[model samples]
Target: MRSSLMRSLHAAGLIDYYALLIHPLTLGSGARLFEGPAPLAEFELTGSVTTSKGVIIAYYARH
Candidate 1:
């Protein structure tokens, strides 16, 4: 799934930028984006967008 792909990319040091679509809902419990122990990496929020459905698409670039 998407988490696997993201984890792979992160492990391989291939994630330079991220575009995450955040839906406007909480399921009470779910998977974490950066799960478990990981090296500290900094990212700067470059931009974002709020869709008509209240979904937020956030853009970030590794710093």
Candidate 2:
């Protein structure tokens, strides 16, 4: 459901930018940000930052 809505919004050019914060730790398994069986979307890297504790913050914009 969420993936379908995201795909629709991106397809209609409604999404201009998005950001993701990646942590150093990891779980054995978990849900991903993007889901569903659709082809992967394209995005441009705008900026990024690495915290003192090693967390990574990434910014992205529509291509």
Best by TM-score: 1
Worst ten-residue run, lDDT, model 1? Answer: 34-43
Candidate 1 lDDT, tens digit per residue, 9-40? 88777889989999989889987887887667
Model 2 gets an lDDT of 0.78
TM-score, predicted candidate 2 vs. hidden true structure: 0.70
Q: What is the TM-score of each candidate against the true structure?
A: 0.84, 0.70
Using lDDT, give the best candidate's number.
Answer: 1
The backbone clash count of each candidate, in order, is 0, 0
Model 1: number of clashes?
0
* lDDT score for candidate 1 against the true structure: 0.87
Pairs in steric clash, model 1: none
Residue pairs in clash, model 2: none
lDDT of each: 0.87, 0.78
Which runs of model 1 end up more than 4 angstroms from their true locations?
none
lDDT of 2 by residue, 19-44 (tens): 77788887898776656554556789
